[model samples]
Target chain A: MKRGWIIGGAAVIVAVFAWLLFGGLQKNVVFFLTPKELLAKGTDGVGVPVRLGGQVKPGSVKWNAQTLDLRFIVTDGAREVPVHSTGAPPQMFRDGMGVVVEGRFGTAGVFEATGLMVKHSNEYRPPKPGEEAHEKYKTLIQQSSQ
Target chain B: MKPEGQLNSSSDRLRDPSAARPPRTSIWLAFVSIGAVIVAQTYAILTSPAEGDMGHLQKIMYVHVPAAWMTFLSFFVVFAFSVRYLWQRRENDDLLAASAAEVGATFNGLTLMLGMIWGRPAWGVWWVWDARLTSTLVLFLIFVGYLALRAFTDDTQQKARWSAAVGAIGALNVPIVYMSVKWWRTLHQPPSSPATLDPRYTMGLRLNAIALLLVMIYFIRKRYEIARLERATEHMAEAAAMGGK
Candidate 1:
């Protein structure tokens, strides 16, 4: 009888553990999507938290330092999603750089990124083949020197 | 002290519980394990290749991944020995479980610190509430609680019973921690250089894993010896007190 209780109790605890793990994961997980897939979701993807990953489209970035308005278009191979942020981008943020932005898609077809992260590896250099030169950002960089 | 195989002859202590002196080879094993770890660390740091984005900072992977591996190993030992103790009612098994939990906590701490160091550079943040990081922290806390629970209990049998249950239950978190990155949309990067998946950091990582395993085993064995000695001393003291009366 004692051994039966022990076994029964363990089963109950394990059941509870399994339930909580799956339940919590379902609620907390944010979907990771590229611009094209996100767009395909239409209204379902709008206003939902997500991690949008893509490269910064070359020559599409615009910044006004005084206003702290940073604008850029993020692209996955074929499609582009315009992204708008209000703060100074990260130090390594540059055109054609891979980035993962966390936020929601606005109804206006813009990705209103709340958290902008520049994807970088330790030895990744700023200059790579086919990337626009960093010198292009000189004017806006000086305007919004941060 | 016994003969040639005395140092880590676990069965020797089981046969003669009062034997306080560990054989010579066991002591030498500890020294040799430490030396090998240092050499392994140096080789890993020197030979690490700079990842395109992470640069030399990627070298931290060697220590970070191995520390994580040891954490899993230590907890698994605790789980295994805990089960054996409960089933067989053996004090030796309980002691082994306690020793493993302690060693595992040390490695858990190492993994957390190394992750933080790497995170600041790679993830662009010091910490996050992502499933992977949070679950690992929970795993550390669970074992730490297991140790604390052992310390507070007074009776040997009671302590063993309670710790065994706690250790086993706490272990449920290990698999959760490992899978959290995959199951959840985590900020933490997914496994890049697992043994077969990618050969990028395999050499340094595997060598360091071997070296860390040696160090962990040495620590647990030496700790078990101390536990045995303490138990023996307690028994003798009890006998002396009763005889005096």
Candidate 2:
């Protein structure tokens, strides 16, 4: 009888855990897509949690440090998506860098990024010689550096 | 040293070969494993490239990722032993399960602490409710409870049986923890290995993982030996009491 109680209790606990895990997963899993893929999806991609990965467009970065409002464009060679982000951008965030932004696409054709992650790798090199990214965001980078 | 608790007869004392020879090899292995880990870590840190984003902070990955992997590996050992003990009811299997749980818990704590240090700058938060991090924390807590349960029980058989149950159930979380990043939205980046990391970084991670794994096995083996000797001593004590009665 005692053994039965223990087995029954464990079964219930496992069941509860499985329920919580499967239920929570529905709301939490974020879809990953590129700018081109997202645009191709039309209305299906808007108002849904998504992670957009691409290279930041050169000369499109606009940052107001005081307000912590930042704007940039993410592109996939052929297509571009305008992104508006809030709060202080990560210190290493810069133009022409690979980044994954987590948020949703607004119907207005802008990516509303709630979180920004600069993809860091040991292989990352500085912008190539004459790359305008270094010159384009120099002021914003300088302010953040200080 | 002569066996302390006198058993019913000289036959019992003579039967224990473990009481005759000290564990010199295990002791030497412990020393060698510790040294190997130290040397490997030095090589890993010195050979790694400075990351452009996290910069020098990326060096923490050598220790952090290996520690996390070892933690999961140790728990897997516990799960295996726990299931075996349940099916066979062997005391040695229970001891092995208990030993692995202790080492797994220590490595789990190390993983969590190091992850927080890496997260502070990378994610801009020391702790987050992201699925990957949260599930790992739950796994740690479950093992902790397993340890506590083992400590509070006085009956050896009861302790072994109960702990084996907890160990098996707790290990169910291990797969969930590993898949959490891919299955759900997480702040933590996906694994960087084999493909994601450059060859330069991959070398360091591989070396460090070997070192951590070696140390984990050595520690678990030493702990298992101690558990075995302890059980032998208890058996002698219980026999002595019975003889007196």
**Model 2 chain A: ten consecutive residues of lowest lDDT:** A124-133
| Chain B structural similarity (TM-score) per candidate | 0.87, 0.91
**Which parts of model 1 are misplaced by more than 4 Å?**
A20-24, A31-69, A74-80, A86-99, A103-107, A118-146, B1-25, B194-200
Those runs of model 2 whose alpha carbons end farther than 4 Å from true positions after fitting are A1-24, A27-59, A65-69, A72-87, A96-146, B1-15, B18-25, B241-245
Model 1 per-residue lDDT tens digits across residues B93-120: 8988998999999999999999988777
Q: Candidate 2 chain B — worst ten consecutive residues by lDDT sum?
A: B2-11
- Candidate DockQ values, in order, are 0.26, 0.22
* Candidate 1 chain A: worst-modelled 10 consecutive residues by lDDT: A120-129
Per-candidate TM-score against the hidden true structure: 0.78, 0.75
True contacts kept of 1: 0.15
Q: What's the CA RMSD for each of the models?
A: 6.4, 5.5
Candidate 2 per-residue lDDT, tens place, A12-36, comes to 9788778767886556455356798
